[model samples]
Target: MGILEVSNVNKRFGGLQALGNVNLDVAKGTVHAIIGPNGAGKSTLLNVLVGKLVPDTGTVLFNGTSVLGLKPFEINQLGISRVFQTPEIFSDLSVFENMLIPCFAKRDGSFRMHALESIASEKDIIEKAEHMLAEVNMADKRHMTASSLSRGDKRRLEMAMCLVQEPKLLLLDEPTAGMARADTNNTIDLLNQIHDSREITMVIIEHDMHVVFSLAKRITVLAQGTPLVEDTPDNIKGHPKVKEAYLGEAAA
Candidate 1:
């Protein structure tokens, strides 16, 4: 069995069938990419994985434990972390200060923004945060305001924050969205580095074919809230269903 598994999952919104009977298996220590056209239920499935949304009739198991009904932070405690499309950070705070917030997170999922001022006396936490920042190549920008950084740097800092928590599974929603080519390439390199250096498993939901092809060990193509195909990157590239999903019947 894979480390994370979704079995017979279904979700609906009034008259809209947001997710059909969907299933996904993400093995340990591999990068799995889920790509599909707009409105293909990719976001819905991702939400289920992260505990933000519960499936109506399915099981989302992380290491054999059911994650349904758990809160987002509760899921985080289970070694799952999610990076949203837009970087989630304290815009006014310095990059280092933003990094310190996660370090002070309480077991009950509470954080004191003012606690940052007291972090100086916490030598170990400081060291750990600094190490993570350095790992993402953001150490030099530690004192810069998070809002002042470029989009790529913001992504780097956000990733550092997630890495500091040391999650076993990282879910990225369009990690390279809205990035220039240079930033996108840099993000790709950073993700490759992280994958090479850690035992973490990543599940990415992306629209960019380049990002998906560049990072995924396995790819699942979703269409109209169902998985059309799942295979290695090369096989997915030549998949007729995938072509029809993105392009019309002509491509297929």
Candidate 2:
């Protein structure tokens, strides 16, 4: 079995069927992309994976354990981390301080966010946070206010924050959304470096075909809240159904 599996998952909102028996199997250490047109339930699926939304009649299994009723933080404790489309950071804090937030919460059973005073005494966590920032090439901006950084840099810092947790599965929702070509390329290269350096599995939900083709080892095409096709990048490129559902014939 894959490291993460979603079997026959269904979700609904009043009269709208947001997800219809969606199924996904993501192998360990691979980058999987899920793409579809607008209103295709991509965000909902990501939410379900991260325990923000629970499925009505199916199962989400991480390493064969049911994650249905788990809280968001509970799911994080199980080695799953999610990066939202927008950078989720403390706008007032410096890069270094933001990086320390997650690291300071590592405790047994329950986790606590260490206050600034408490964090000052933990040399090891501080060092580890610095190392992560350095790896992401943001160590130089350690003291820079997060809000002052460019959009791309803010996204980089956000990813670094998620990486420090050493999650088994990383879910990215439009990681490169709103980036210019240069920033998009930088994000792609950074992702390649992350994959090469670690054994983390990623499931990215993206609308940008360039970003999807750049990082996806496998692609699942969703349409009208249902999965239409799942295939490798090459096979998905000129696929008739995929072209119909997402990329038009001209795009193909």
lDDT of 2 at 72: 92
lDDT of 1: 0.89
- Model 2, span 108-136: residue lDDT tens: 33554434556578898899999999898
Q: Over 4 Å off in model 1, which ranges? A: 106-117
Q: Give the CA lDDT, 0 to 100, for residue 56 in model 2.
A: 89
Write candidate 1's Cα lDDT for 33-78 as tens digits: 9999999999999999888888889899999999999999889878
Question: What global local distance difference test value does model 2 have?
Answer: 0.90
lDDT scores of the candidates, listed in order: 0.89, 0.90
lDDT for position 20 in model 1: 95
